[model samples]
Target chain A: MSSGEIKALVFDVFGTVVDWRTSISRQAAEFGAKHGVTADWDKFADDWRAGYGAGMAKVNSGEDEWKIVDQIHRERLEVILDEYGFPNINDDELTEFNKAWHRLDGWPDATTGLTRLKSKFIISSLSNGNIALLTNMAKYANLPWDAVLSAELAGKYKRHPRAYTKTAELLGLEYDEVMLVAAHNDDLRGAIKAGLKAALVTRPDEFGDAKKPDLEPDPDFNYFAKDFHDLADQLGCD
Target chain B: MSSGEIKALVFDVFGTVVDWRTSISRQAAEFGAKHGVTADWDKFADDWRAGYGAGMAKVNSGEDEWKIVDQIHRERLEVILDEYGFPNINDDELTEFNKAWHRLDGWPDATTGLTRLKSKFIISSLSNGNIALLTNMAKYANLPWDAVLSAELAGKYKRHPRAYTKTAELLGLEYDEVMLVAAHNDDLRGAIKAGLKAALVTRPDEFGDAKKPDLEPDPDFNYFAKDFHDLADQLGCD
Candidate 1:
């Protein structure tokens, strides 16, 4: 470890470690029920999540200033609140409900697999989500991360080379020594391009009935696993 | 939990969470034995740590460029190496030795108390140490941190208003909701000046007979306790 290398296993949070789609959908349904607004709650989750990409893209492109994922979610939440017949929700309620992202449910393998991997590697989050959101979700989902790192710290979102390499730098690791475990192929590709190792942990239910998931990894990826447990097994974690 | 507040108990790592002086002194004695040189290892720890303030103050005052705590420690280690009769140590060996700070031993109450605090509030590290240093130290010391935050993230060292306020902002909490727990009154005062709550957790043996410890808190501080366990009890964490 003297060559500025502290081996780390950084993770992508949203769909890989946590089942955001189902978690948000379930919460949205309950939120809708309380407000007496009954639309397709799953679609609402989708629409709200859709803003995330555009929000990050704008910031990355210099079209907008940097904002945390919580603000991004709130921006999207407000748009869909009116569109989805949730106009009566007060500002305070809206603020509380926006944290639904921070209360996501981790996939069953997430916590235990991460714990196992953490025994050997410096395990942390490398998500586009802000640190606050990731930290809160880690506690809420019991995803025992050694550190809660995020694109917020790097000031860049996923798929950006800076986002991938900066996270490795923060862990005092060479890019090659840091492995990114994610559900998205593009994120893995981004990691590879940034000189970090990549492992795709597929989540087929990530999109629910909304969109298809990325089940295949690119040839450049170092490993591919059905879930975090399989990844941990491949990584030789007990 | 709404209203931009996620209550957190952020900690000052060095003397508050870990017994750095004794740990560094003990490691330095072993280092000296290997190098065939001997001196007051405790004094060496003190001298090496003394450079920390000068390093951060230079950067803070814009007289020197930004550098991490690791680099600061490295600079200090190199100077003390010559004065303490270990001039033959190579750069690689020096680098490894500098990381002794990253492997400091946690206080008896550090781990258990943090685990208890984590049960109710988000518990993280709020140190002047860099993210890598704090993260690695957390691993070495078996300390549980929800997030590894630092003055490095804010590009300001502790005792700076930005360092205190920025950490709270990163956690998506108001100043008052994020309490800074430290073994030093100056740090607690810094947090209070930044509008965050403060708690003083004394480490009477912090300096290893080198200097006096800060056992008393300011009148404005929210709490004072003997150790993390006492702090935990006072904070109402089960």
Candidate 2:
């Protein structure tokens, strides 16, 4: 569990590093305002995210074919726009709005903490987000990733062993040499099952009352922290 | 043709950025001195690189199964070691020597020029080098790549359309928005055929006296520069 043994730190982006719920809700609220429509922004964010997990799960289970997260978001947006009683939007407008996911605001500790961690380890995103989403998010949020990797590269979703192992293999490191840092216990557990190390980072407000955050860590988890800065401090990163 | 239109610039790494020939030759010369052996180091570098294109082509043509560049390099090293009359080399010893490619020395303009270009556009290595080789080289040579993309991801060799197209697709850029910057005309031509923009950055000393450098650009190339710094200048990178 020593820092010296760890070669890379792969992260789950949506809730771990970026505040997707707040960011998405805020963007949706703004879009709704411009269109003279008022509705529950939090509900919109949650509904959008619900589509993401369901879409990915279907792809993972082979019930649906492979489609990028962008496509999934677009598909759900079309459905939800009708449910919210919004006027019909053009394809161009819908496409630009769909890219709100790319412009997510980072968690308060994200940039500063990641800067500290970058001094010590090769930090990268191991999200289910496609490469384009992760890459664009890195640029938009100024997240200094040494690499932007995704489960799309492995043709599987997170929680799958291939996704975790493929990332380690691409980095040319042993599974134990890479650590998955995330806000979810399930993701950390999956990493551990795949022979990779894990660190639990709690994001208490991630779901905003709609869903419960995994605030506790497994006994076997290497580290647990309130945020990225706390994680940096615990890991001895500058 | 406009700088703003270029979303990503994919680089040819070996000689264009890292001086692999000189780096490998120097490392090999040092290894030779330690072992009390001597030969033309430049020829040694050429011989080592000679196996690379053919090895990748075999995989692309389905004549051989998919293999990473690390394996290709190792296979070449075994043949060259015996030809160069090295004696009593073990598996571990050969592996250590094979990683010389991973420890290449960057050209003087590489780091600064790339930094300048990166400020204006997404810059990544589109070399035939596997992810591990490119990642280790980035750390070793201090190349600031936005991403370390490789032909390894495409499961094909360069000069094949898939290699160039897959890189652009992975970056989520249109083919025309992604530019291939390389010293080799054939590589640029391949990229152009695949609908990507092409920039010819000439490295006159890439082949030394063993072969002629790509001193002339193809008529269809969008930009031509004397070196990486010149390329940056042409691209209007600050």
Candidate 3:
């Protein structure tokens, strides 16, 4: 694929750009320690993320009213805090603690790789995360994004065609002119179905041994790279 | 007014940071010259911009369906093109020409003042323009926006309470914590009425001799300055 045709690279932030599992687990473990609680933090992270799909599914299916990701996370947190056997926490404390998702750490290659890509293409987070979460994460992790985009803007979640197409439309580009770079084949498939180009960048440690990473791309994916730098190289980005 | 209370400074972009009147007039003049058509370019700019408020008002009032600023501009462009008696232009040419709004020139202090303000606050466009128009304008004019926000995301236009409130909501801020910085009192009044703080920054030459600019702030406004730099100074931005 010619690099000249690409106008923007919309990234799936949770896994592809940041080590969300590790970051969330570490923060959750710290919060647990402060409350004299202990459990498998990785499992905690996974459980928290597990709530994401169901919450978004309800909204996408029109079963639930439209809500921001922060609200969705907070609702899920209320359930998980009870399941994890945490003592009663005040609303203020819970609200602050729930912001752990806003402080995720970028992958080792994320900042540098995105910087390189930004030099050529407009780089943005196209996660299901709300605008505030992605914006705070960009600041916290020093991710240089030309813009911060999210499925929240579309009032839908990823895997929904509107999530992919709305992002392209927002950027004033033809669907194929924007490329979706993600660590998951499902997301790539969604982008492809929405008429956007797709590139898979494998993040082997994304699930922290609790889940299998999609280490290989489908035959139809335009490019696959082990890291952002590798992906930049493959895309011929300067 | 305490500067510390303002977490984000949302701007009215068209005639505030960008010299839209001059920029549009120049481009239109060039296009007219090429097409062998001659008319008052300043009047042309005013006519084009006059359509913007009416277009947005229709959306705000639910009298018309939601449409992006690009579509609004194109709709006006079609009417103005006929008024100027220009030769028939094809869709491709008209589309490219309609993007003139996306190539506005920044006021002399716009970039520097915004850069200073950005060091202290999240500075973003909160215009009736769509994200694509704002993003392209930022890239073209070198405006340093932390985010490109617009009424397009809110599904309403400015002066409507939802437009101001939704921007703050998306930024995860209380309405009072977000300040609207603009060249017009009417826009500032709308923001203040929506519970946001308002800062009026004068753009004396925004309309040249065609119309009088709102060079002074309404007495109820929280802050007033001669230009963006003056606003930055008043806000204590470095």
A162 Cα displacement, candidate 1 (Å): 0.8
**Is 1 or 3 the stronger prediction by TM-score?**
1
Q: In candidate 3, how many Å is residue A154 off?
A: 2.0
Candidate 3 chain A least-lDDT 10 residues: A1-10
Best by DockQ: 1
Considering only N, C-alpha and C atoms within 3 Å, which residue pairs clash in candidate 3? none
> In candidate 3, how many Å is residue A229 off?
2.4
DockQ of each: 0.88, 0.62, 0.58
Q: What tens-digit string does per-residue lDDT give for candidate 2 at A59-154?
A: 999999999999999999999999998998998799899999999999988999998998888888999998888888887888988777899899
Give the Cα error of residue A68 in candidate 3, in Å: 2.0
Cα distance off (Å), candidate 1, residue A218: 1.0
Top TM-score prediction, candidate number: 1
The residue-level lDDT of candidate 2 at B97 comes to 92
Clashing pairs in 1: none
lDDT of 1 by residue, B1-238 (tens): 4343438999999999999999999999999999899899899899999999999999999999889999999998888889987858777788889999899999999889899989889998999999899999999989989999999899989888999999988998888898999999988988889988888988999986778999878899888899878877877888
Query: Candidate 1, DockQ to 2 decimals?
Result: 0.88
DockQ of the two-chain complex in candidate 3? 0.58
Off by over 4 Å in 3: A1-4, B1-4
Rank ordering of all candidates by TM-score, starting from the highest? 1, 2, 3
